[model samples]
Target chain A: MPGKALVITSGKGGVGKTTTTANLGLGLALRGHKVALVDADTGLRNLDVVMGLENRIVYDLVDVIEGNCRLAQALIRDKRTRNLVLLPTAQSKEKDAVKPEQMKELVKQLKDEFDYILIDSPAGIEHGFRNAVAGADEAIIVTTPEVAAVRDADRIIGLLEASGLYDPSLIINRVRPDMVRRGDMMDIDDIIEILAIPLLGVVPDDEGIIISTNRGEPVVLNGRCRSGEAFNNIVRRLEGEEVPFLDMRGDGLLEKLKRLVGLR
Target chain B: MWEFLSRLFGRENEASKVAAKERLRLVLVHDRTTVSPCLLETLKEELLDVISKYMEIDQAGFEVNIEQGDDSMALVANIPIKEMKRALSRTKN
Candidate 1:
């Protein structure tokens, strides 16, 4: 049976697209499904580093596309999970080096060999973003709670719908619960109202995420952290499990007082 | 005390969130339509010019806005006609 191909994208940069790709890919692999993580950013590749497979990148996606290496040879097997593989992008190549048809063909070939193919898209609606989303059956849009991020996500969702990929789910990342409770930051409800997409999961702003990335390890590997649990919920939801969204309301004394006085 | 009381009672008055949503709503209407504010202004000017030839319009009350429907966007124009000059000319003849 053919597997599913999903592209993780955000029209805005630094909204956790690569991190979500690494975690979700590893999360699926840990569930015993053979998964392939494709770093489609081409010139600016970081998925490999996030997955801790950067040092083993002997060949990359461009090598396979240009016939310099076989597809299997370009796939770097993860050290922790044998079922998870990384198809790193060529750091030196430009975004136009690969076309949409080529991406579609490559993902088609990958779908037969793996249970899931997760493409990590680059930021913006330009050639790189187009190349990343070309082959996917579904899309996961990641956004922070900031206004700019949500606005960009809304534009990306419109473009995706125009391209015939409708109903793309959302991942609200880097949410500061305290700020949200204080009405200083946009909450999940506000984001959903603007983006108008189904909720996938919300990842809290975690300092551990920085440490994990620094160590070239995905946060999902720990499972004890808040962001790690969020990624796990995304994985479960992807597998047809109805996982409830995390209640990220920080019930501090001030929050309680505000709620009592109807100031929240 | 008045400000504090208003803040206490207005629980849903999240200034930033409300502002962001309003800004996004207005911007996305233009973004999706690919219509610039300049273009809309030009269009309104041309529409008024063409319509004023046939009737005296309430220029101060005229309004143009892009409204978002369930699945599509519509450019709505409310041109209040004060008097029909063409009808007055016909009546005189």
Candidate 2:
């Protein structure tokens, strides 16, 4: 059976699109499925740095498309796992350097060999976004709880629908449970009501994310943070497993007691 | 006591999230409508001009809005008519 191509995108930048792509791609590969992450952001390539495979990138998407290198030479195998590979993008090329048809053909080839091809799209509704989504069979939108991010997610949903990509799921990132409890931030229901997309999972704003990113390790591999656990659950959901949402309130009596003793 | 308690609880004013939700609601409506205010304004004016030749419409009461629906959107306009104009006499050619 051929694998599915899913694009991870957000209309706004700095909303963790690359982070989610790296985590989800690795999460699926850890489950023994062959996965390939395609960085379609072209000039603004980032999946390499996020995945800690920057130094190993001998070729990129543009090289493969331009026939400068073969497809096998461009794919960088993960240092930790052989099942997952990354097809990095050329940082020096423009967004229009690669055509939509080329991307579609590339993803089609990857689908035959991998269980999942997660295309990490660039931020915006421009050519970069279009090329990234060209060969996608499904789409995952990453957004924060902020107004601008939510609004852009809504706009992306409309654009996706116009292009015949229907019912894209949402992943809300950088959620602050304490702020939500204090009514200082928007809650899950508020965002769901506004965006009206199926909720895949929510990741808390854990400091572990910053540490893991700096260390060039995905949070899912850490396996200690709440955000990592949340990502694991999302992976299960993608595999048709019904995992319950994590308890993010963080105000339970036990937690409060721990906080009192400075054990948190 | 109530005043002091309210102050202490920081409940004297509404939560800022309420305002965020309200603003997002309004903005999403405009975004989803997919029609610019300038375009809508021009359409409203042209519609009024076309309708005025046949009847006297209540210009102050005329309103145009985009009613969003599930899987569809409608351009709804409410133009109140005060009176119909009599047809002008025409000589046979």
Candidate 3:
């Protein structure tokens, strides 16, 4: 059977789209599925750096599209796992270098080989966004809790619907539970109620994310941090397992207070 | 410290998230409808012109807004009328 193609997108930049892509793709591969992480950002590619496979990328998405290299030659196999590979895009090409039809064809070919193909889209609702979304069977909208990020998420949701990819699930990333406890940050409930989509999972803001990114090692490999556990839940959820959300309400004292005030 | 005290005192309702929610609600209403504040202003002027033909309306008190509900939306117009026209001149019945 062919694999599934899922595009990870957020209309606004700096909301962890690339990080989510790398972690989720690697997370799936760690579970014994053959996964391909495609960087569709073209001119401003970052997934290669995040995956720590930058030195291995002699070929890219543009090279494969223009018949410069075979698909097998362009894919960079992860050093950590034999099941995972990344098809990095060119850092020199423009967003218009690859067309939507070409993206669709590339995804089709990838679906035959891998169990999951995760496309990391560029920020904004322009050509790059369209190209990233064109080939996917489903979309995972990633957004932070801030007003600007959620607003852009709302717009991306509308655009996804307009493009015939409906009912895309959401991942609320970088949620600060302490802020939510203080009612200073928007909670999961607020984001869910606003987006009105099925919840995949929620990732907490972790300092370990910085350390992992610095070393080009995915946080999921650590498997101890809150954000790592959250990504694992999302990976399982994608595989159709029913995993409950983490109780990010801090320790016992705050938990008791939250329960007293009817907050979760 | 003040923030912690407010949370402890059950004053969480007044937290900044309330303001964020309200702001997101208003902004999304405009975004989903693709209607800008400028467009709403122009629409209000045109609506006042048509409503004035039948009744005297309070222009200052006239308001038009798009309110979002759970699973539905409403284009609500709150127009205060001074008096209804007693004589029907352009009545085509």
Q: What is the DockQ of candidate 3?
A: 0.41
What clash pairs does model 2 have? none
| Of candidates 2 and 1, the better by DockQ | 2
- The CA lDDT of each predicted structure is 0.89, 0.91, 0.92
DockQ of each: 0.29, 0.46, 0.41
Chain B TM-score, all predictions listed: 0.57, 0.59, 0.60
lDDT of 2: 0.91
Leading candidate by lDDT: 3
The per-residue C-alpha lDDT of model 1 at residue A2 equals 96
- B27 Cα displacement, candidate 1 (Å): 2.2
TM-scores of the candidates in the order shown: 0.79, 0.84, 0.80
Off by over 4 Å in 2: A256-264, B1-7, B12-14, B36-93
Q: What ranges in model 3 sit over 4 Å off?
A: A253-264, B1-13, B35-93
Candidate 2 lDDT for residue A38:
97
lDDT of 3 by residue, B1-93 (tens): 998887778687555889898889878877787667899999999999888888999888999998876645788999999999886675544
Pick out the ten consecutive residues of candidate 2 chain A with the lowest summed lDDT: A247-256
lDDT (tens digit, per residue) of candidate 1 on B1-93: 887886787644567667776776777765668766899899999999878777989999999888877546888999998998855454344
Q: Which of candidates 1 and 3 is the stronger one according to lDDT?
A: 3
